[model samples]
Target: MTRSPATPLPPPKARRRLRETAALTQTQLATRVGVTPGIVRAWESGRTTPRGRKREAYARLLKTLAEEEAARQAKQKQQEQQEQQEQQEHQKPDEKQESAPAPVPKLEPESKPEPQSDAKPAPEPEPEPRPESAPVALTPAQAFDALYAFSAPALVRQTFLLTGRREQARESVERAFQAAWERWPEVARDRDPVGWVRATAYEYALSPWQRFRPRHRHPEPPPADPGDRTLLNTLLRLPPRHRRTLVLYDGVGLDLPETAAETEASTPATANRLLHAREAVAGRLPALADPQVLHRRLTELASNERLRAAEPPAVRRGGERRARLRTRAAIAFTVALIGTTALTARTAPTHYEPPVSPGQAVRGVPHRVAPGALSDEELELRQKLRDQMQDGPERLLPRLE
Candidate 1:
């Protein structure tokens, strides 16, 4: 049996509470419902009211989360009760001993009680040993905050270098962090969570579909730094692979193998790309012709104040993710069609027999006609006709009888 979907109530507080209970970051919730995090944040803050399917989906997801949270809370309460009961069971013997009456001292005829001093006191209870406490789990907020604090700035800078667009750089970093916020528990446990964020930001910044996007208008700065501008322009103009490879190797200081893993290419392929990239840059800029000079210049550019991020912007990316998918599918279909046509043409038999010329009809002497003997029936008919011509018609009629 199918369960009815939950209808989201119109109250903003109600939705916010549902999201809190579900432990979904606004970004995660937005992603689940196909909206921007800013939109989700607005909805939660009562700044906007989603309508139509958005409203319906918002309600349904919240209701489902509320149900799940209720179930989880109920389960936790049951577990706590069971744990208390077990503790009580373990303490039963001691509790029973403590509750029992102290053994009575029997008095004998010759027995004499010792003389009581000025101080007479009843027996006191011995203190019980303390039990060890369980370790506490870190709250989601603390985990997420810590990760964002340590990683976001670096991700923004790295992405800015990769994309050369300040707004796009910020978008990429935020998107990466949003993903991290959603899976914080696992991220917190990771060996290099920062590395994961960095790689994600790189991929986001280097998204192929970003090419067709309209450029962001930047307010003119006081004056451009010649070296930084030149370097950025050079990096931006190189093919994406070469540019990204150089940044990862020279900018981020990732080793060849690390660069390969992050870029999703083989070590040898990364090596080749980096090598060619260095040559490409050298060809363009005489100052970067030497390897040592190139590294120093790259490091200086990475350290520039212009490369640092100011604050995370409230924008969204990944419109390009779907567009890229469509482009790849279209390109693949076209390639397949071309390949099939080429293969067919290569292997198929040719049908081009040159047309015979009009005057060539007399060619080959028109293959001489050969005479042949007539059939026996024709011969007999001829002989009968000849006899008919010699003899009278009455003689031929009598023979028929």
Candidate 2:
């Protein structure tokens, strides 16, 4: 498989937010992330993304953000609870003191009640409150480890494929983490933060760049041996909605219904796009080869490690930043390819058959065939013809019998 040229993952704005929140200058964050202050500004402003090992550094920074946010929330909650408990305790003593002297008067035993057949029994007493445990905060290191472990390279790869640019995917992923970190206290409670991040990243990946930024060009078909390059190219030529349907249905192993949900498209629309995409692929494939076979082969190739080998860097450098950049670039490349392929398939001609044949008689009009289904004119013509023939044909035949 021919590796496409890699692009650098661009920097994101989270750094600026972090700095502002921390009341620190760009120099401060740069010092922490081990980059020049200028680099910090560039990243914050979307000028460029950090490369290779720098991603780990960035991840670490995000972890710090999560930890700090978590700590702040935990402290606030603890303070609130403590204050409420203290207020209650202070009020309890006063109430008890006032009531202490008002003991119940001694009284004679009451007469026993007669047995009742229909009375319902009362419910049992409520359980006592269990001792509450101390709030445990996730350390920055622990949070970083979790994020690192849960971070799937595949998502980045997919994003890269969609955008045909590396930095964009990295920024998207970083933004996802930044969002999560900003609300870490709430997000951490979720059973699947990784899943949430993945979903968010994909959403970001799907979104187009703002009008100011360069619009993405459709991805070119990858070389064959990786599959039918022409078919892939055709698939890439489709509209985004249709292309997504095709990818989710074929590339991502999603059924029609699932693909519909994933793409947020109606079932009929999804089905139509998928059908068209398949037809386009079929049209482009070798006559002897089945479209299904080609689709499966392409899917396999996409998933293959050999095909997925990280492309060589346009400018090689030794370090963590470079590595992160490479990973992001690879991811972006993959996503662009998948999204483009799906889009392409949707727009291409599908060889759809006509629903109606020319000269077919229609009800209510003359027998002239319409471009679409029988036009009103044809319908009327047909009705007139039917009425004319209603009387026995012998009525119009010559009397010479």
Each candidate's number of clashing pairs is 1, 54
- TM-score of each model, paired residue for residue: 0.42, 0.34
Best by lDDT: 1
Any runs in candidate 1 off by more than 4 Å, and if so which? 1-137, 216-223, 290-292, 307-401
Q: Candidate 2: which stretches are off by over 4 Å?
A: 1-151, 185-195, 210-232, 255-257, 286-295, 298-401
In model 1, how large is the Cα lDDT of residue 225? 81
lDDT of each: 0.72, 0.59
lDDT of 2: 0.59
**Distance from true location, Cα of 133 in model 1, Å:** 13
Question: Model 2 over residues 8-94: C-alpha lDDT tens digits?
Answer: 332243445555666676667778888887676555544245766776686677667757877988999999999999998887654
Best by TM-score: 1
Per-residue error for 171 in candidate 1, Å, reads 1.2
Residue 204 in candidate 2 has what lDDT?
76
Superposition error at 327 for model 1 (Å): 26
| Per-residue lDDT over 1-401 for candidate 1, one digit per residue giving the tens place of the 0 to 100 score | 99665454645556666776676766799899999877785565443458778888887887788789889999999999999999989977754434667899997789777887976687898889888898786676666666666667766777777777777887787777766665566556555678767877777788887776766444324216887888778787888888888888887788885676556554577899998888878777878977778877877665574544433222112433545677999999999999999999999878867878675456567665686787999899989888775654454444554
Give residue 380's error in model 2 in angstroms: 99
